[model samples]
Target: MITVKAPGKLYIAGEYAVLEPGHPAIIVALDRFITVSVSEATLQGTINSRQYAETDFHWRRSGDQMIFDNRDNPYHYILEAIRVVETLALEMGRPLKIYDLDINSQLEDQGGRKYGLGSSAAVTVATVKALCQFYELPLSRMDFFKLAAIAHFNVQGNGSLGDIAASVFGGWIAYSTFDKDWLRTVLQTNTFGEILASEWPGLKIELLHVPNELELLIGWTGSPASTSRLVDKITIAKFAEHEQYQHFLAESQKCVQKMINGIRNHHLPIVKAEIRHNRQLIKDLGFFSGVTIETPALQELCRIAEDCGGAAKSSGAGGGDCGIVLTDHTVDQARLISAWNQQQITTLPLSVFQLTEASV
Candidate 1:
């Protein structure tokens, strides 16, 4: 059996500013992950067929076709991922065919849904990693990153590519898009397969559970918020006022230093402060409609986090899947968790780690 454990992630800085070119964003991989295992199988259908069992799923290969089934949506996401690889293989004139393959996964956060962490990206990374092992296909982290990006676009219609990049490369990364068509990248990624691998280590992050005991409250306004809509909003907003956008970009950049200080010193205050300011900036840019953030449940959690001396903000595209919070006192974690429970919201106790790789 081939087992791969991949990490979810949290964006530390450069939230909306990443839409502007030349801005660098920082993220940390979380202790939570989506684990995948592959074993040689004797089954019917195709080598690429998928099946699910509880937190696990299997994909088997038949003679020439591929099939997929899974207990988790992430598997559907992965099946979309493999189609990307197949397209690439065909483009390169090295068409890949499956004999029979099985896939199983364990995602331990938000009942296996995305809670602001890169769940889709992590699953995409694992799928590619497993495929690499299954076919003996030699690929670098960068190559896998590109493949995951394709998968991301397939699933979400549009994505920043930041999450997949962090999952595949790990550690710290700086990614920016200067114009409409170009992206610039620099990796301080933590992994075992690079020349500077010996010097890079995992980043330290303290995960806080807001006391309310609510399973992370996700308030969708009954419709999914399209990422493209948000991105286009920012694009038009930027051109109308470069000076303001430039200033916001510069202020957002300051979060990088704040994050570094918080991580290095284990100072929760700095982290909380940065999160508040980051959320405000994103809010100021119109990512939050007054109504979405105004939802009673969401507003309650935000108030609870603030009351508990923590900071909270919307997670994904804001119309909501989840919101991320950072707390001040570890001692108050219980109180915070209890508060969420009382409110009937979900609280996930997650740890943050910068990207790094295991010895293969």
Candidate 2:
């Protein structure tokens, strides 16, 4: 049996801009993860009968394309993973094999509430790893990231794939978005053969050095944030044309640089400053876009973290998802937790997920 686990991710900075070409985002792999176990099977495709069994899935081939049974199924990533890996095997002249896999995740609550950790990305990463291991394919972290990213992009048309990078490499990472236009064209126009013929383009990923003095904490607001809806609320603008939006991106770019440099150089102050700037910046975006970015609970979480001598802000889409907290050990974590509990926010237990030999 091949058992593989991949961690979910937290967005440190660079949310919207990362969607733009060549823009960067700082993302970290969380200790929370999805686990997949695969073994040889008599079936020709995937054999999953766990949490995913609750969802509908179909697997078959079309004229020239290998299509998922249910393209709109929420578990489409799982089918995409199997299809992509199978395409790789055929391209490399390796015999395709069947496998039975079990999927499990730790990113949600017992009541099925997602903590806003990147669960879909995590599952896709795990599926990629499990398939590679089952096939005895020795793919490097970057190679695995590309394959996993293809699967994710196949399901969700838009994403920076920073979560895939973090899930594969783990720890702190500064990631640049890939060429979305190229990938979209390929997926839209190509068949299974064409997809295998077009190898993945190299995407930039840098492992960031986190300061020893920095203490990271994750807290969940209990309400899920729909990132797509929030992005839809904003109007994309040219930097020179829309003055306010231009200023927003400019300020965000500066904060991104400061965050990358601060984390890399062990400069806590710069990182902290950028964190606060980003929180307020998102609020500003809310004001201009007329969409509420930070909910009352999220605001209270940030307020409590700031009052406790730490900096805190929403990690990703923000409407009411998880927030990242930065501080030193001197801050009373218990007090912060108590305050959050009072506001009904759940403090998440997490750390940077480091890769090891056996886990993959």
User: Per-residue lDDT for 1-360 in model 2, tens only?
Assistant: 988899989998887767665566889988888998987765344546355556655344443354455544666687789878877766666776655677888888887778888888889999888888777776777778878888988877776788888999998998877777788788778764465456555357899888888989888988998776676666443332377777777788778888898888899989988888888887887777677878888888999998998988888878988888998977999999999899898888888887777655
Deviation from truth (RMSD, Å), model 2: 3.2
Candidate 2 collision pairs: 58-69
lDDT of 1 by residue, 122-240 (tens): 88888777766665666766667666665675666544667776676665455543232321111223221331122211222222222232222222222234445666666666777
Q: Candidate 1, TM-score vs. the true structure?
A: 0.66
- Give the worst 10-residue stretch by lDDT in candidate 1: 195-204
Model 2 has how many clashing residue pairs?
Answer: 1
TM-score of every candidate: 0.66, 0.89
lDDT of each: 0.56, 0.79
